[model samples]
Target chain A: MTGLLDAAFVLLILTTLVLLGSSRIRLGIRVLAVQGVVVGAAALLLPNHHVTLRVVVIVLIGTILDAVVFPILLLRALRTARVERETDPPVGYTASILIGVGLLTACLWGMKYGGITLPHEGANPLELPVAAYTVLAGLFLIVARNNALNQILGYLMLENGIFLAGLSTAMEVPLLIEMGILLDVFIMVMVMGVALFHISRTFDSIEVGGMTALTDWPDQEDVGK
Target chain B: MIAGLILIPLVAAGAAFAIRSHPVRRAMLVSVAAVHAALTARLWVDWPARPAPVLDGWLAVDAPGLLFLSTCSALFLAAAVYAVGYHAREDVGEPRRDIEEGGLFFRNEPEAVFAGCMLLFLGSMTGVSLSQHLGLLWVGVEATTLATAPLIYYHRHHRSLEATWKYLLICSVGLALAMIGNFALAASIPRAEAESGRINLVLGDLLANARALNPAWAQIAFVFFLVGYGTKMGLAPLHTWLPDAHSEAPSLVSALMSGALLNCAFLGVLRGHQVCTAAGFPGFSSELLIWFGLLSMAVAAVFILGQTDFKRMLAYSSVEHMGILALAVGCGAAYGMGLHALGHSLIKGSLFLTSGILLAAYQTKNVTKIHNLLADYPVTGLLWLAGFLAITGAPPFSLFLSEFTVGKTLLDADRPVAAAAYLVLLGVIFLGMASAVLPMVHGTGPVDHEPAGGQSAPPGYRPPLTMLVPPIVLAGAVLGLGLYLPVDVREVLRDAAAALSGGVSP
Candidate 1:
């Protein structure tokens, strides 16, 4: 069970990286959805001999929100905005992957220095490795993505990594906080959607670059009129 | 009583929203401000030590929380009064127009909704400052951001919309990161003690269990908390959204942001510092804060020097003062931090309010065009100029006394290097702000062309006694603090500072 969970973690990171390299917004969202599923499945594999029905319900809700609902919302927003190609990516694909590798290496170094050894008996050695990769991959998404929509994806990726970190002590967070977290993310996505719609209507583009025009030097015309 | 400070504005805001009559809505706002001020005054006089009501140890308030609550409540009352006059003038001067042909801009009606949201925003900020639990604090902070979003978009212009979007997106992301930090903090607590679900992440509990917290995880949490709250606090590197938001928002809202909102966020950092100190890592947190604070000062120096927009210049000045506040706290000077925080709150609040009046009078936010301000509006112009002087730490203002206190503390701590650095930064900021501000105050510039409609001022240009009173009162308070500190007030300041320093003798 632990081995499968560790493998799922690695898969999540790979999916995050793939999402970062993808120019198509739909594909990015799809990749994120897949990563979320892997995370949910990994959560299910945690050691829980005496899990209550309440816990089961919570895990189910969390998985459904992370895996199904969030991605659909992103997909809908992407389709509505018609933002298929990320023309002006913040960082190139190859450079981003390389940076991801460096980040993963640093994560391993950090974890090692902190002396965070897994205590769960029979857990695979790959647990730490997979965890490190997931976190760095999330960081990559955050740094490399230029579109505001994609940045949200990156944010979720980082969140997924943080969630994975808690697997060592799973079931610690209350169901309510977990729910609140999911609700917060949903609201954030909705607000971002509204902002994107407004931006597109005003600027004729949904690119994050459109925002750069906001801070332009004040024109005398504006002052005079 | 703390709950009342938050609830009164909230309930009044709802009432204002329901009432369509402009005059009634305006009256509601005034009454809410009056009631809030009265309650705050009561709290100030009593200085009651009511134990914070705990939700399973999720929230509580201590001394600092009470202090911030009082400060926020006081500022909110002042701004609420000012807003009534501001919106009334706006309504009389410029009626809503159909400007759809231009772009995605709409001339919003001057209805009660804006005033209502303004009060709600004020209430939410008060809630945040008084929150003892980390989770409640997070909710309060996030609520403030949401409440203020509508206020920023009040004008419904393309620029206002743009500013609102930036403010919302950046701050939402930052606050989300802070939430992640809160979770990490929960995760850092030891599980060996065996609670039912998760260990409650209250400040006091965290402080008590500091020794057992995972150091690495705690550090990660601090970083996120700092960045998240720091962004809201308008720290450098994360303050890109501040100037635009402050400049575009109504001047009354800008005053609240500069005067009140930034301090609320600073309280978040202070909470993190307390945790860090308890975790035996005071130096780490202090160093990080000082680094950001100094960086913010440097950023402000560059921007304020060449700033042409008067509002943006004031916004940058806010960044500079926030930097000084952080630096003073980081210096670990108990009295200095307490005095600086309170003094900055008063002076900066007055300055922003004065700036609002100037913006209304000149019908422009440009510094270059508005010259000989004293010639145009004597009382406001002189007050505006004095506000600038006071905010930049000139003598005969509360800020001067506070800055001097911080300087003395720095020197006494045997940190001449840090003291000198602070002095130099202060001097540079003063010079930069003076150069940008003095010209607008006294320089002779071309007269503004009257509107085609034959209005002498912009449609909403009336500066009523109500609009003028708050800043006058605040300015006098600043001057009074500078000239004399009452024995009781001095004692309170000492107590507050000592609280920050873990009850160390001042």
Candidate 2:
């Protein structure tokens, strides 16, 4: 069971790396869906088969929503926007992948030096690496992606990493708290989506750079003048 | 009763959302504000005991909590009343309707929704001050951010939208990092103790077990908490979003943000300080706070000196005052620090409210334009000038008393160097702020010849009694605090300060 969890975690990190390296918006969403599935599988393989009914319900609901519904919604948004690929990624795909590799190395090195004891109920070594990789990948997406929609995807990836950290503890967070977190994230995405739609409509471009002109201190003067 | 103080605004917010008529919405807002102030005053008179109604150890009203709550409730009531008058004077068309052709902006009538969200924002801030559980406090803080986003975008101009987006995204990221810190704190608890499992991340619980917490993790957590909450508090290096948001927001909203919201964020940092002190890490936490405080003061001084927009300068002033408050607390002077927080809140609230009036009358936020404020609007201009003096810690103002107290406390503690540095920063800030503000207040530039917003105030363009009265009342309160601290209020400050200093005066 532990080996299965570790394999799933590694696969999740790979999917995250794929997300970081992809310029195609639709492909990135697909990678996120795959990553979400790995998280659900890892959750299932935890040593605590005595998991409370509430934990099961939360995992079930979160997995279904995150892995299936969220992906579909994101894909629909991409299709609506009709952007085939992310042109001029914030950082090139190669650099993002290199940064992910560095993050993964640092995670392993830190774990060795810190020598922090892992939780007894589950696999410990795999936990920190998974979290670090996912977090790095999320940051990559956020920094490299040009579209506001893709940034939201990165935020969700970062959240997934944090969720994995919580799962490593083998303690069931209260259902209400979990629900609150999920609801807040949902509302945040909805708000950002609306803002993105408005931005697109007004600027005639969904690119994040277009909004920079709205700042009081614009870098270029002659464009609008 | 503590719960009622928070719930009333929340219910009023919902009511405001349901009603469409501007008059009805405005009336609901005023009534709620009046009732909130009245209830808080009653609480003061009743002198509620310590730990009034602890909810599963998640919510409690102790001395410091009560002090902040009362101050916030008072300031919010004033801002709410003033908002009605300010809104009434403006044309009720869509805010983005006047954007230049080909400009990147969208306009909509979210005024009713905006008004409703402001009330909710007030409620959430109140919740932040009153909350005992760390989790509840986090919830309240995040809720304030969400509730106020619409209010920030109330103008719906392209610039306003950009400001709102930055405020939302950066603050949310900072807040999320704070949540990770919170989890770190929870994880640091010892597993051997039976009661530790039941520990609910309440401030009291964390403080009680501070000595047993993992010191390394606690230190990391404190750093994250400071950076995270400090971002919201508009501390330097992390305060890039503040001026833009404050400048673009409606004046009434700006007042609340500068006055009430920043203090709530400071409270979160103070909570972390309490935990760190109890955990035998006082020096570490204090040094970090002082570093950030001094940096914030320096940055504000520079920005204020070079500031072009009058509103942006005021925003920087807020940042400067927050720095002073942080420095006072960092000095480990309990009484002086408590007084500084109170004094700053009252005076800053008054200044922002008055600045709103000036902006409304002048029609432009540019510091160079619209001179002879006293001649144009005698009462408001005088109030604005007085507010400037009071905020800069001039003699005979409450801030002067508070700042002097901090200086004395530092000297008594044998920190002459820090005291000197603080004075220098304060002097620089004073000079910078005065250069920008004095011109607008006293210059002989042409009076605002045209009625602002193309609407002549009906027959008599005098500000409504609601808008004019609150600032005057607040100014009076500030003056009273400066000249003579009431016995009961003094006693409350003493107790609160004592609590902060861990019962040690030094």
CAPRI class of candidate 1: acceptable
Best by TM-score: 2
Give me the runs in candidate 2 sitting further than 4 Å from their true place: A44-50, A79-82, A115-123, A143-146, A169-180, A213-225, B48-54, B94-108, B194-196, B410-420, B445-462, B503-506
Error of 2 at B435 (Å): 1.1
TM-score of 1: 0.89
Candidate 2 docks with a DockQ of: 0.31
Model 1: residue A76 alpha-carbon error in angstroms: 3.5
Residues B224-304, model 2: lDDT tens digits: 788888989998988988998998788778878888898899888888888888888888888888778888988888888
Model 2: how far is B477 from its true place, Å?
A: 2.1
Q: What is the TM-score of chain B alone in each candidate?
A: 0.91, 0.92
Per-model DockQ: 0.33, 0.31
lDDT of 1 by residue, A118-172 (tens): 4344545555556556755765676566677777777677666656555544345
Which residue pairs show backbone clashes in model 2? Answer: none
